[model samples]
Target chain A: MGQKLTPGDSRSNLYNPQLGMTLIVKTVTRWVKGFIFLFGVYIVLYGHLTPGGGFAGGVIIAGAFILLTLAFGKEAALERMSKTVASEFDSLGALMFLMLAWLGLYFGGPFFVNFIQRNLPGKRFHLFSAGNIPLCNIAIGIKVGTSLFMVFIILSVLRVVVKKGERRMVQMKRRGE
Target chain B: MVTLLTVLLFFMVVGAIIAVETKDLLSSIICVGAVGFGVSIAFLFLRAPDIAITQVVVEVLVLVILIRATISRDVTAISGDREFFSMTVSIALLLVIFIFGLEVFKSFPQFREPVFTTMSDASTNTYIQRGLIQTGAANLVTSIILDYRAYDTLGEATVLFTAILGALAILRAKARKRTTDSSEGNSDQ
Candidate 1:
């Protein structure tokens, strides 16, 4: 219990317990990330009735993951959603969007036609009022959110590799000198 | 509104200059983020809440990415020898573009004015006048994007998908290894 400490000493393992930011950030994120994610879902679901739609909501969702990654390191964030799963979900989103359009085509209408709206238009200003819009918004939200997360994860991983490569180059140059 | 926009634009330009001229990569990223937030606020003043929200979140993510990439890799001595010359040339080009933009602004419509009602074509007018009844959506922008211009949304989604594919292809570790002897490449996998 009597461990001496100095400023900027990450090796102490007391102030810096893990491979992430301070404990305060991690604690705050644990409390706030769920709300951020839920707000993003709300924006996506109510996209047709509100100012934000799929893109905004999707970006918000990705922002939550990014915040988690920043606060708790990549390993914790990847535990929630691995890179492979993110990529697969990205593909699934695009496929779902395309399938929606193709279903419109198969139903004897033009591509992206509002067939559901024409047949059974629900009550106005309601959740299911727009025929294919909510579905499209969900698809786009899934696509944009997962792909952006993947992009962030990939870029961060690449940064590590780049740093290592640069260090190796510096070491080689010093050895040559 | 115009005054607010002018102030925001001025601050944004100042922030951009500071971001570009600074040597510290971290402070430069923060300055760029300030400029992005200013742009988001300007979007709000322009009555585009959708763009504003997207811009704010995207800006934060981009800032996080940029800072994470360059925070530990400080390269203060990497400035180009012709930095002053490049800066002068860019400023001159910007001034010329600003003059041309002012000329183009003369022919544009009034700010914040809905243009659909003034046009003679009644077909396009239906979206604004009867967008809710037709699409059963309250938000006109959402109805326009997901219904009236759905094919365009499809194209945008395809574009995003292609862009992510390109990013993954370029950034994957195994794809860049030309030789099998590199231990670093193997370890990454």
Candidate 2:
């Protein structure tokens, strides 16, 4: 989905109309979004010991992407990154998580066995603790981010292409040379 | 019983109105989404999550395709007045279809219990005893889905493969791109 949507700002495409937005407002939005995204990351990382997991945290990060895209124009958002690349990253992330789970078998254990163990030298209630919860969260975050990024990118690209074609035709008609 | 159904019916109607009347293409798409969601909720209150999910996902795909198609239309090319009459007639036919659809609901039995929960129970119990002894997983859904029902997963994967193949077939182009607006034409060209 993301592969279909991401467009480059070449001679055929658009420029960022919202980059000139006020610094204070933009700064605040970015800061808030960044913090929320980071907190979501924390949620996924410690999922084994905590209530939040990969899915919850992934959605939070997606929300942050949405905020960043809205604050800047779609072109600026795409300028910083490609949707195709993000989708590939998402697929790779899921693959790694499953691969790690299966890798447990090679270590003389069952699939998805919680092999790595470290204690706070105490109980099972620390953020730095939890065996493989963090790993699961990372997978979820990637899946969610890619899905949402695809949805938004598809909508934005479709809109931009139509607008660009219209503008081009109008410009050609007006030149009358 | 009647009141709840009536309220849902009314909501769908209003949503349809808003979707038709809206000027901005985005607003109309949103209204279409809202109408689909409203119907999904009604399907839920009718006690079917699977149905709700199906409707919502399909509707999302449809609305996205429609919005893209509409945007690609040459907006400057206005049609004749007869097109409006044709639209009204088609819409009236749609309302008649809706009336018949509601009547068809009487044929299905009311939700006594979720069929899957009961069906899943027999499979789940077997897996529970076998999984502990065989697979070491306590979660019945996971055990059944991954280990016991590996064949089903294979089938599901095959289904996904078929879908991707179909998409690839449609997306593939042999001729040079003639600058058609579709993503397929763009990429192939």
Candidate 3:
């Protein structure tokens, strides 16, 4: 829906037809998105040591992306994160999480066992001391973030067309139709 | 503390009622979010920070989804007769549930101390004591979820994966159907 302007279109650079909000809003979003993303990463990494974990962090990460989309329009946002890339990351995250769980089985323990060394000398509450928990959190964070973002993107692309006074919701064309 | 909890609960209930009764979809969604925030605060006050964090994030995600879903649609109010009937049924159901809940609450013994203290098994005590030593994590909730009950966490993750996959599949199918229909129309034309 947002792919109307060609690269060589004169208006492409001058007026971003894909521009979502006012200049002030976009400027605020540009400043905030990075910090929000970093906070999400921090939450995921420190999940074992802190209250926030994969799901919460992932949602926050998705929130940052959503904010970007809201501020910069779908085309600009998709340049940063396309649907295919998001879908692939979602699958990759889920697979990585599953593989970690299977690793426990491969090591002759039950499924999802904390196989890595948990008790390292003088490493208590340290970031790297969680024995696969951090890895799991990262995987879950990626999966949840991408999935939620995908959901938002997909839903936003559904255009409600009122043709001849009959309302219909249709998936917007990849290129403007 | 009790007064604080009571106030939060009152607000939560009011928010929930507003969410259900509101004609505007966006306002209803926001009201629901307010209720969720109140619940999260209650969870924190009850010493369940992990749950509170998850609840708040989930609430926000849900709010975003709801907003996106309704953004382009016309805000059509429910018909008066249907709305009145639904409201009547809902209020009646709520009254019945409240009465039953009060009866149940009365049946339970009064707690002189904390509810966890009254328990005979002391599972909470055991988890608190052994959680750090066994799991090597400072957060008890993390230790329980990722270390002690890792399998349960795995199952929950799998459930989440399945749900997302299902949603993606459905949405993709709809898109495919639309494309094929348009293509057929073009060929006919």
Candidate 4:
């Protein structure tokens, strides 16, 4: 639990729980998380042209959040992305991907067809050349990233319960009463 | 190249053995990660960059999740008859698999030869020739996954979605159980 704030006391650091690792870890994580997130976006956006795609990029993005949780504690990470928001993002990503596929059915011939005009004023190896592939990658990236982070957060928040006898024995030893 | 592959394979096998035999959970996880990385390197050497990338990222996520889930658990070493039996069974299975794989490999073409040498008009040739023109993507792998075999990719996405939903439901149910247990304890008091 975090420290409580009095009426006149500063509100800063009052809500962040004591759950993270050491100071060095927090500092390193702070510096690295942004770069990792940016790298993930890069992977997602350039999925068609690059080696990685949505799933790999999404996992990298989730890795950034996991690093934050590991170094700065679950509370700090959750403050940045709560359970509700993560779930919503997960759902939205999935829906967006599905809708893209549906667009093929509605506008184009078959399911998951390359509906959009693929040649969009870009060179062969340039970005924005792939039609619906990039869009799909972005949607899958968001969905996978949020879902994975949600799993990590939920798993980390689980409390380990000690047996009643063990708890009582520890308390009695400490109190000697 | 063959020697390099042999060395990498040797390292992968060693890592796998250490992963299985290590008593410390964290060390075991690291060993498994090493094995995964070795596999990724093999993929890269084989010119499968896309698979290598996916493998590496998946390995990282798996390691992170496993460590988080097992951090608080007991790391007791498994010993005794059951462990011995399992080990024996696994060794036997591995030997059988090795023999069977060698037999299967004998039926296939030589490793160094081009795989498409059997047919002049094979689908692989067609894929390489027209993959970029039809799909308009520079990366052949992307075009194959997203356009050529889109139905398979759709199936994969569906499977991923289903897995996430299942995980969420299971975690939520566990939380509900904990809450009900706490409420019952309070009412009893």
Candidate 5:
């Protein structure tokens, strides 16, 4: 992430109020972001009933956040979900999925035994159906969504180290350096 | 359907070739994006809406990241020293890989036929045939991934975590550490 400031611009664009894209993009983002998020949630929740599962839904969810960041800059996006929080959620999702497997094992079955379906199978094609599949999907969705968003943020924001009266990033050495 | 798929794949290949030949990095990225969207549409035509949705979203995010990367950076390709030789070698390698891939696919079951149903075990067939009844899930794909073969999904999640860990390790290097030490990590705030 190279930060390009114009010739007369002193303050970095990161701190600028007009940091992001043009007015049309921002306004359209404001209108469409909620729908994108809702669509993502719908895909995640109905994953058992539909063609999409956790991975696709999670990517859609991350796209909503990425849209916000692209339209209104990183600040607005970070205000909604910060990098640290996203990282925490990422781990939490993976842990939740692992916990589901462990629970199945503890309940007198092998790992990931679909314990709910074994006991009381819900009605087919219903929202509360699919035993533990929906829960697993939700966990995967959260994990993937946060992980991808964090990757985008990490890649987009460059660390500018102030060193020796110079304001520039210390470029990491390439291979064979 | 086969003809449609062939046409789609042909366009995708052309887009890829244009992407490689284009000097402008932005247009090249967009052309690559076109190739990806073509694959997504092809996935839909193949009746894999799951994959198509994922492909489109992933493609959009990749384009976003790529454009962001090039926005403040150089947008033109700086011709390297060994371009022609590398291109020849890569094309040769791709042909070799394609032949090997065809061999691998020849050993697999035919398309649109569930391979598990052909096995000897009756109980396995029961699970495969009556998965909707057993799992109470409408979508067989979801049941197959999250119920029957959950360990695979778990492994995939772990792989994703490991990839993110590697990315963070490389991206957050000495520059971030020194800045955080000096600024008490309040720079983001």
Candidate 6:
């Protein structure tokens, strides 16, 4: 979402106001990111009755993280979180998704099969009543959020390290000792 | 159908402009991200969510690679390349693509077609129609990815794995060269 400030960045019109006033920036960005993220969640949750599903929701959730990165710098975005933690979250998401598929084996008759027993008393077309569809959405949300967070951290870190290395190489070449 | 495709083409043009004219490298990559999403939306409109998802995944990976490349690359506008002929060429290409799309849409059978019209009649009908029955999985796309086309899902996993590997190779290339240089320095000493 956001690019690292470069030597040429001074030429660009945008500024990193988030860095100076993070308290205000964080609040606003959180709302913006949260809205986008939740809307994706809603789409995935009700995908059975309408359009959208796990992958779409997952990407949208991840896009929210990209927004966070753009609004706040990488460190600020992960100030309370860490890379390994995000990776763990990603694994947990993948695991739970697998577990849901196995549930089909016990009740739905086979792997990846949806077995709706029609126990819901609510009328059709309502949220929370999409049988197993909402569950898939939840799984997708978790997997996407965590994995995307991990990707954000990794890419940001690489950018930082690469810039540092480039500076060092120049310094070494300058010193002819 | 023409309206849908026209809207999609509009998105493509905006995305191309963003990706090309944006001076900021990261934003440019993110512009590509925007293009990817738009392309997937177009795919969805075409009734191919499977391709859409796959396209999304691949494009995301491409964006990551682009971001990595931008760390060493610079973007500049091709001011000199902006000529009447080039503009004509681009517009002509876009018009051709639009015509081809419209032609394909025209070839599709009307909704009256019995077999292809209903979701239950499709090839993956076995897995897709399970949503109304017992499996409990609601999102047919999820069901397709995780169940019916599980093998394709595995292939997607492999694609991601390959992407991760490619990223590793790219990001580490400089470091590897640095390590080798340091080793050479040690021998020189």
User: Which of the numbered candidates is closest to the native, going by highest DockQ?
Assistant: 1
Which digits, one per residue and each the tens of the lDDT, describe model 5 over residues B24-120? 8889999999999999999999888999999999999989888876754522464444578897999899999999999999999887666766766
Of the candidates shown, which would achieve the greatest lDDT relative to the real structure?
Answer: 5
Cα deviation at A31, candidate 1, in Å, is 1.0
Ranking by lDDT: 5, 1, 4, 3, 6, 2
Report per-candidate TM-score of chain A alone.
0.82, 0.68, 0.83, 0.81, 0.81, 0.66
Docking quality level of the chain pair in candidate 2: incorrect
Which stretches in model 5 have alpha-carbon errors above 4 Å? A1-17, A159-177, B80-128, B177-189
Runs off by more than 4 Å, candidate 2: A1-28, A42-57, A74-88, A104-134, A150-177, B1-9, B20-24, B33-113, B116-189
Candidate 6 error regions (>4 Å): A1-27, A115-123, A160-177, B1-121, B124-162, B165-189
Which model is ahead, 1 or 2, in terms of lDDT? Answer: 1
Model 4, span A8-108: residue lDDT tens: 53334323345456667767787898999999999989988878888788989998898887776666677788889998998898788788889888884
Candidate number with greatest TM-score: 1
Per-residue lDDT, model 1, residue A115, is 77
- lDDT of each residue in A74-164, candidate 5, tens digit only: 7668878988899999999999999999999888899999998888888888899878999999999999999999999887765343333
Model 3 residue A31 CA deviation in Å: 1.0
lDDT for predicted candidate 3 compared with the true structure: 0.77
For model 3, the stretches where C-alpha displacement exceeds 4 angstroms are A1-3, A7-18, A118-122, A160-177, B81-94, B107-116, B120-122, B180-189
- Candidate 4 off by > 4 Å: A1-18, A118-122, A159-177, B81-94, B182-189
Task: Indicate whether candidate 5 or candidate 6 has the larger TM-score.
Answer: 5
Pitting candidate 2 against candidate 3, the one with the higher lDDT is 3
lDDT of 6 by residue, B1-189 (tens): 768788888988898898787766677778788888888888888787655865775587568646654665432222334579998999899999999999998877774364545555577656555544443444566555654565575455445545545764676676667666866744554
Give the CAPRI class of candidate 6.
incorrect
User: Model 1: which residue pairs collide?
Assistant: none
Model 4 C-alpha lDDT per residue in residues B1-189, reported as the tens digit of each score? 999999999999999989988777788999999999999999999999988988888898889888766665543344333567887999899999999999998988888787777778877787799877666677787777777787777677678778877876787786777766976764554
For model 5, the docking class works out as acceptable
